[model samples]
Target: MMNVLSAQDKQRWRQDGYLVLPGFFEQAATEEMLGRARQLLDEFDVEGHPLTTFKTEADGEHVGDDYFIGSNDKIRYFLEPSSLSKPAPGAPSKLLVPPAQSINKIGHALAQLDPVFRKYTLENEKVANVAKDLGYHQSPRVLQSMIICKQPRIGGVVPSHNDSTFLYTDPPSAVGCWIALEECTPQNGCLSFLPGSHKTARVSSRFVKDPSGRGTTFESVAGVEPNEEKWDELDGWVEAACPAGTLVLIHGNVMHRSPPNPSDKSRLIYTFHMIEGAEGYTYDEKNWLQPTKDMPFPALF
Candidate 1:
């Protein structure tokens, strides 16, 4: 494995809860991945897709339908809520544009199912090395992967929250890798993060399946209640706008968000979460996402 993170980078990660590495991936690589994503979007049939709109709200509520829950090991497409229009009362919603232009994301198992995504995810040694450098000394596994297509005019907003709230594990060890497939700008809803919030913020709420097994919802973590103060009001927030191929490493507890893209262009990004898989670190069973017995989460090494 090659050396990726330096001492300065490590320090920055500890102090800021995130690190941005410009040009971490080459232009050719990003373009190839982006092209493949576009191909997949173009080929997807939305005729009978159930029209599951992907929603993540500012209040910590998220979409927890069967489609979202069952996508742990399968690649699936989700629609943008803003792009759907109601033609009549008591009727199903219809998309305003073509399927390719209306999709909000393709997610949950791209790395495991698609060879194009796998090359940059599970097969990327530089990423694995970065995990090792970040203190995944015993074992680390890729938990979830997704391609977020911030479509022009209809892309939704993602509220401020930490990744660990969605991908919880005992002792709270999860890191996020965000790769920009296209140029990200403030006008196109680039990510904004609260620096060093990881040190003060706790994973107060968790996204988990209901005990009845019908759906999922957010549950308060034991002894950690939600803060009355809003996270967005905190100081030292910084917006990250970078060119294609930039990689951003995010600590699990860092508070971050991206505004809705209302521009003429789209901002495409690929993101995956990693968790400690070593002994003594337990993955929560009630977590909305789970690995099947037939197909477990693959380790980095």
Candidate 2:
């Protein structure tokens, strides 16, 4: 494979824990993705809503009733009729929606066509390579999409935390590519990351409930001591203000979070994970672990 990442870019990713790749997609691709997303929302009768988060039917309730209350019609479109009436197989009370296989299929195709997605999926091989360098060989994993449509005066904040907490994998060989489908600014709750925080030796296992109240935070697992200076230095965290089509590649272990989208305009973004393949790696099927054995690796463009 051709080396898409420069030496400096790799170094920066290793040291800073993330990289900002500007113009990762052309205008046409960006517009297309946004269009497809809108069409999907329309197909599901999801419009004029506050916020939307998509999860498998098995995990739907964990996503909360707030996402489904006013948008029942939309929710029904994505979920099977049986799912709405009966609970998912494993999680009855949780209201988990079975995996939206169709949505995943569409998203996978879009990822191949979108420039920003292609760049991260194809050009940015550094993440997997780095894991190999570190002695892990796992393939890429596509987790889930987090789509948000912030209604006027209805947005909320997402506290700062590392993604590593939610994902459990040996050797920690996963990276996520977050692409902005709309203009993201500080006012719109753009993502913020703690530069180079992935290299930290500690791994916390705190259980911080997500909006759905089922997820846990990793900050408690690592048990990292707070350093005022380090916090202050990272406090100068940069907000990724990019036009649609900008791709932000971040380490799985990096500390990151986003505020609420205060703007009326929706902030659309998709996140995908990739890993290097090797033996002796174990995955937790019971827990939502990234790069699981059953989940297919993200397609390399």
Candidate 3:
């Protein structure tokens, strides 16, 4: 494995809670991943798809269902909320565009199901090398891989949140690797991060299955108020504007979000989260996404 993280890179990760490495992957590789994502989107059979719209607002109804919960080990498609027509009273909602163009993301287990995605993710030694450089002292397991399709003009906003809230561990050791498959600009809903927020912010809540086991809800962790920490504040936030093939490493506690895409161009990106999997750390069984015995989380090493 190659030592891609230099002294400066480590410094940036420590100070800013994130690192944007330009040209981390070649153009050809990114284009290939982008092409594969588009092909998967185009080939998706939406005829029977529940057309579940994806949203990340803590106050809004989260995207969850059998289709979503079962996606832990499968590649599933999710629709963009803005691309759907409002349903009339007692009527079902309809998609305003083609299935291929109406998607918000295809996610949760792309690396495990898709050969192409697997090649860039788990099969890539660079990913493991980077995790090692970041000092994942105990054990690191990759999970929750997705291709975020910031579709043309209807891509929805993702409210500021931390990865640990979703993929929680005992000590909250989740790191996200966000790779730009297409050019990410402000017009197309590029990510914005609150610099150093990881060091300051606390993972006080988690998205877990409800007691009924029918749906999910955000519960305060250890009696901490989930709303006490404000993520809406934009002061000192930096826009992560990068070209294709760029890789952005995000700390688990960093406050980050993206605006809606109102531009004609789409901002496509592949992202995955890694969590500490050592014996001491507990991966809550009540968590919305659970690993099956047959397809457990793969070690980063």
Q: Give each model's whole-structure lDDT.
A: 0.88, 0.51, 0.87
| Tens-digit per-residue lDDT, 1-301, candidate 2 | 3444667877778788887776776778678667756665456432352223433221123332344322211222222222233457875332233232112112322333445444444545653453344332334544433344432233455555555544545555566667787888888778887777777723445222343444422233343554333442456576667778887887877777677654766676656655434465544543333233343435442
What lDDT score goes with residue 5 in model 1? 91
lDDT tens string, model 1, 1-301? 5778999999999999999999999989999999998998998898879899888873445677899899999999998888899768898888889989988999899889899999998998887888878774378788789999999988888999899888888778889999999999999999999999899888888889988876778888898867675888877789999999999999999999999999999999999888888898888689989999987998877
Question: Pairing residues by index, what is the TM-score of model 3?
Answer: 0.96
TM-scores of the candidates are 0.96, 0.62, 0.96
User: In model 1, which regions exceed 4 Å deviation?
Assistant: 58-61
Worst 10 contiguous positions by lDDT, candidate 2: 72-81
In candidate 3, how many Å is residue 82 off?
Answer: 1.5
Residues 1-301 of candidate 3 have per-residue lDDT tens digits of 6798999899989999999998999988998999998899889887888888887776558977788888899888888988789988989888898889998888888888889989988888887788788785467888999999989888888889888998888878899999999999999999999988888788888889878767788887896545465667547989999999999999998889999998999999999988888878899888999999999998777
Candidates 1 and 2 compared by TM-score, better number: 1
Residue pairs in collision within model 3: none
Q: What is the lDDT of candidate 1?
A: 0.88
